[model samples]
Target chain A: MSVLPLVALVGNPNAGKSALFNALTGARQKLGNYPGVTVERKAGRLALADGRPVELVDLPGTYSLNAASPDEQVTRDVVMGRQAGERRPDALVIVVDASNLDNHLRFALELIALGLPTIVALNMVDLATRDGLELDAAVLARELGVPVIATVAVRKRGLDHLREELGGLLDSAAPEAKTLPPERDFDAVRGEARRIARAAVVRETPSRRLTAAVDRVALHPVFGLLLLLGLLFVMFQAVYAWSEAPIAMIEGLAEAAATAARDALPDGMLRSFLVDGVINGVGSVVVFLPQILILFFFILMLEATGYMVRAAFLMDGIMAKVGLSGRAFIPLLSSFACAIPGIMATRTIADPKDRLTTILIAPLMTCSARLPVYAVIIGAFIPARDVLPGVGLQGFVLFCLYVAGIIGAMLVALILRMTVTKGASGGFLMEMPKYQWPRPQDILLGLWQRAVIFLKRAGTIIFTSTVILWVLLSYPKPPEGSAVSQVDYSIAGRIAGGLNVILEPIGFNRDISLALIPAMAAREVAVSALATVYSIDAGDDEALLERSLGDRLKDQWPLPTALAFLAWFIFAPQCISTIAVTRRETNGWKWPMFMLGYLFVLAYVAAGLTFWTATALGLS
Target chain B: MRLTELPLRQPAFVDLIDWSVLSPSEGQRLREFGLCEGASVEALHHGGLWGKGPIACKVGRMTIAMRRNHAAAVTVRTGPDAAP
Candidate 1:
């Protein structure tokens, strides 16, 4: 057995580094957190033509080795072999955007000074050529003192040459410490890069007219904001419209699977667990796959097409007014999918205060986890009328719920900025990369990764929680002839009964209170927990048990209570994983505890207000 | 005049970068993006209704957006060769 050599993929942001990594090591990637930090650690395995394997780590994209931001610090640490628990990489694969060599080559020059065995993958060569620039690879190689291979990462061009070069270097001893130009100052390195570029790169004609033409409209103050909002509206609308058929298919499959299990197995604990715990619990979360995938698809597309930066540029004015950098927009937008990644993405925010404020408000963005709770509540309570000619009233309400989260986040950020995190606003210096057509493969890969992550949670955390809830609801035989449901005597029932004292004022019944306990672990689990609890409470009423969870909730709870539940979820301190990630990212229990406290108070007050207002209006 | 005072669409040569107005890291970043002395920059757009938001400037072949406060630190002079 031999240790696989570690090869790190390093490049500037949006330089097609990840794309090249994916091209070289498809489906062999593992994503985790680096040692103690929440910064994402993505590593993959690449095999050479001769079947020898090497580990490839996709380091966080950074502009330079100045170590200004956490992400950049991690990149610097890994390249220098200073990151704890990680050995120095055997080789370095510097992925550079050929179209943007003038700007990218400076970083390339800085990396070369590390005196490591390095190969430059001149990625996006096709785009560079399309832009009418002629790049002499051999000349660049000679000028940089390293092998340069032109690559179109998206199209898989020049990857074989890249693999061959990497393979040949795998067996070579570490390069001896070569005396290189002093790198203490960036000016010297940047000057050297300019010299190298002038000697190697030839320009035929200037390109980027198409990009500039598109930007003219996309960056128009009036039209640009409208276009951005329209794009977001369409994305949310598509999440609802496109996910309908797939959600229905999944629901149908879950029902059929439950039915099959019920008919095949004898009436026993095993059968009950199979249908109620496994099928109903995991099934509820799994149905959300389509919506999550749709959200990520749009996000990944916006990112790949280079429009996200322009969006930040457009929103900077409004965002800055709320005391957040425009760069905060990307992380906050990512929170719409999940807060963990959104919080992690805040590393790009160079200012610590701005990054902290972004993290504090990220959970208010209404992640996809909350979609299940909102979907069930809205489906049952909100009537399916056409608000517009084609839009369902349900989706419109769902959109409003999402908007409420965004507005809440902004308010919180404003409050924090004016008080605790108050300071000079962070600088919003960010590069607006040239626009390109998003590659389908990259989109597919991104969506695939999201789906896998969601399903893995369903299979593990949701699965275990559901089984535990089932046991809690099923155990402890009722006293003989006791005039109550079996669940009334169970442990979970007793706990909910006690909790109802605090919950009743907010229009939550004992059943809703029971669901709230597990909902803390993950918001979507509340729906499954309610379903399992209600099904058991309906014992001996086969038809009632078979009724859809939404129908049952509508029958059991008043409209005011349902509305209150929706309001509760809007501010709920749910999703323990989010809190844990926050703790890790902030490197303290203080912020997470504070987050939990404020969110709880907000949820209680909002739910109470909603319930009382609806009751006062005679809706109850 | 400060880079922030530069008219939109007019190119100027950066004269001096005053590090006093910006934090150390921000000054380093601005320099890394080619906003150092002698670099040619063209103000492309000013954000917000009152033009108090981030200013988008073209540096080399890249366009970067920075707050007006940070842009105020860099003094520039309009030049014929620097015109876009």
Candidate 2:
């Protein structure tokens, strides 16, 4: 009869709130966007001890309700009952790091002043004890006039006790809990919070801090940069090496399925659609899933181990020189997996100019979708021998593609900062979380989420684009005994023919042009489009030798053209989802249009230059 | 001395923070993180390629990363009177 009681978890940035949320909800969580805003709304179902199912929402971490960042603003608004789409929380769980009580308590004290029914979760007590901290939770509860629970969210310690506390708090049509902490100025409140924190701590032993020890090596100017680069190189190499067998297995399965479809269906359009469009088309995109998953695995691990912020710390000076802050580095690194989320992540950067510059340059970071395009091209043209002792030529080429994107993004950011988005950059401020062993369940959950997104793309967007491409290439059958190939007479070919006038100068053949249009929907669709076109073309000329898509490409395209195609993807800005997200993030089409124009010009010139240089070098 | 000028690895007490030198939001953020007067502080490390970039300061039990320019507004004292 009543709406599910909404309980929100709130905390500072590094207070282990996410781990606690995962522990409480397990896999029953649902993620969506808060209406009218791009911030994530994460909610899950939690069954209280009284057999009542309540909604557990995880609010973004913030230091205070002062609304410093977009994330913090959302957290403040949701708790204050003014957020665009969220209802005011029925109760609040204020999570604070056990070791960092003095700083975290400032916010907790402020939240207590909001007069909401509240509980303090003394999270990460295990880490605190490891750091020689001994705290009395009873003192904290007594001082704040609310219940306090010590929890190690990652280890699932004290969770049942936490649940019992939650049940009791909800059971009382508890007389509206009055504001316990008195109103005071920011400084006074913080000072009182310091007093409370001191009272709660029974003893503070000076133990060898694991964070400082790790920071000595990981943040050393020379050694730290080297470590970051080395980790990246190894990750790229592993992406290519570890996923090889799985990729081969997927390709074999696709071939067998296509063969079965051809035999099961009659000789008509149904057979062609199943085999050429669904099988080979979407199958080409699906084959790259292993590489994407491997890439995400390394990223998630870097994030879990608390090394990502250190990477930003190391990059600060260089980023400053470009009129940006080190905070931009995290989003840029994430753009390697996808531009949509990377653009969304920019909300944490406070300055408008800096956030805009970061968004404009994000698409240049060779996204995982671009990986399939580069992999096929390099496999067909480049030699696979060891270029150096441990560097294979193919992997080196892949790494070069990634570097090209990074270099291009940096240059673009510099130019944009000096021109369209020019302004004084905002200062960087953040917490450096302590180093700890990454939990297996957290990493697996992250990987599982990415895998689901990848597969859904393969099923929906890739499938539809492939089917449409098949139809466009299959119709308008060429006349009997005619010299014109079936493609030349089809609708898609004529469309490519019109566009070839502009693209031919860059060494892009008609086939590449045909693949280009469909790829605008999503970057990975280009691979499927090419596979479909080639598969359909193969069926037309029965006398042609049967070959894999790579073999077909190698036989047809010149080395210069292949290299030019690879160069184009480094700066290509055609992903529809990326553009849509940019629109939502910037709240206008102006920046996205500018992004499209600049990237298009850059891609054309880069492809043309690669074509000319490779041809000039006698590699034609 | 301003916290930025405080010698590395030396423990000091925050004396006076010129909040006027910082933007409202930046000042509020610093206050929220407990980098106020009478708090114990130490400059841990300087990060950047050239080691002239942002300074990592220990304010209470947390390590806070802040740009050099922002750290220049907070005055600190390192004598016996600096003890909390």
DockQ of each: 0.67, 0.81
- Whole-model lDDT, candidate 1? 0.86
lDDT of 2 by residue, A451-559 (tens): 8989999999989888888999998999899898878889999999999999999999999999999999888899889888888888745444147889999989999
Candidate 1 lDDT, A1-620, residue by residue in tens = 77888999999888988889889999878988778766788999998868888999999888888778777888888888788767778889999888777668999988888888899999898877877788899999998989999998888899888889988877788786333334467787677776787787776586656666787788878888899988988888788889989999999999999889988999888988888888987887888889889989999999989999989998899998899989999998999899988998998898889999999999888898988898888888898888898777887898888888889888999999998898977788898887888768878988888988888888888888888999999988698899877777899999999999999999999888888998888888998898888777776577986888899999999999999999998889948899998998888999999888988888899899999999999995
List the pairs of residues colliding in candidate 2. Answer: none
Q: How well is each residue in B1-84 modelled by candidate 2, as lDDT tens digits?
A: 998899888999998988887888788778777888888899998887655788888998888899988888889999877785
Best model per TM-score: 2
Q: Write down the lDDT of every candidate, Cα atoms only.
A: 0.86, 0.89
Cand. 2 Cα-lDDT: 0.89
Q: Which stretches of candidate 1 lie over 4 Å from their true place?
A: A177-182, B81-84
Docking model 1 quality class = medium
